[model samples]
Target: MGPLYCALISQIAIILAFAIIGAGLKYIDDAFDEDRFSKKKAISIAPIIVLIWICLSLFDSVSATILFSILFAVLLTGKIDNLIFKVSTIALISILFLTQMLNLLWIPLVFLTLMGVADEKGNDYVDNHATLKLVEFLFSYRFCMKMGLLSLCILTLLPWLYLLAFLAHDGAYESVRMLGKISVAHQRKKKHTIAISPTVNE
Candidate 1:
């Protein structure tokens, strides 16, 4: 009935939406060949991701939160194995990078580069490369979001942790939960990728 309640509900819905899509992604990747998702499966999941994006659009003004969520959805669509979706995601990121945040261009650039490494597994050099850079950047971004949320929480405090105050804290970083998370492919193939990636004579 109130703003805090509304925020709490919206954030919960957002988390559930991401989690559901993430789980669906697991199945999609596992049950089929790489880059192959059925139209039925895609049909079921697309609306959920789209709905979350819409909700996030209305809920938060934080650029990182919105961008990351859309990025995640784009990643999921790629798993759908549709070239169109992949191209659309690329176009979306390019538009964002070139047009929206000049200062933040490096963020998406690095993000896309790191993502490319997963596909570059066969190449000895790329596979041998450590994920320290990507992980480090992710941790840095996570830290920034944490600080942003903390400051928002402190500034918007309402009489010792009322509903509004708690919601305010949660509200600041919409993408907070996704920070430092493993993509579906990385989670599924980490073992093989890591072990064979370093070998020169494979």
Candidate 2:
């Protein structure tokens, strides 16, 4: 198949994976509680998220795509309500930040922060503390994950951007659908961390 077809299939698979996981979480809310959290439950979604990452990562250069996908997976692992997974994710981010393998460390930092917010919502808890209130004050409700996906999509299209510019055409509009795939991976990973963050008390 061609790049367009490959990209299309990847987008569909990523969307389905995230939708399945989201439905599962909503359907089995109690299963996520401390008493019921198990290795089986915590790990069942790991492979699925990884698969989505792999699928969507196909849109860019192999190394960059895979690296970005790994970052997304690491972030998603934190949503399992397992300390080890969360810590590992944080550690990986820190190492990458220090190593400078991943550009724009602030991107992951902001990504993690947003994940923390979403995870708190997933636990059916809203943090209304003075600090959280301050954070909420600082950030708008425009959905950071969406913003990140938009950035990723735009970045992925850099080559196409130049091509379009050279061609002096309107292919950019045609590229919007590509965002669906990238957004699925980004949003899924973001949601997992967001659902389990600490509540800020005021």
lDDT leader: 1
TM-score of each: 0.37, 0.35
Question: Model 2 compared with the native: what TM-score?
Answer: 0.35
Error of 1 at 144 (Å): 13
lDDT per residue for candidate 2 within 1-202, as digits (tens), equals 9999987775454444444433333222333443333447545654454444334333333323323433464355344454444543465456445655533334544553454355344333323433465456333232333344445447763223222221211122123223434555687788876765554321
Model 1 deviation from the true structure expressed as Cα RMSD, one decimal place: 12.0
The models' CA-based lDDT, in order, is 0.43, 0.41
Predict model 2's lDDT versus the native. 0.41
Candidate 1: where are CA atoms >4 Å away?
27-39, 63-81, 87-202
Q: Write the per-residue lDDT of candidate 1 for residues 1-202, one digit (tens) a residue.
A: 9999987786665555445544443333333444333546655655554445434434443433424533553364344355434544565556455545444334433443344333332232333655566654444333333333344346652122222322333343323233313344466587777778879556
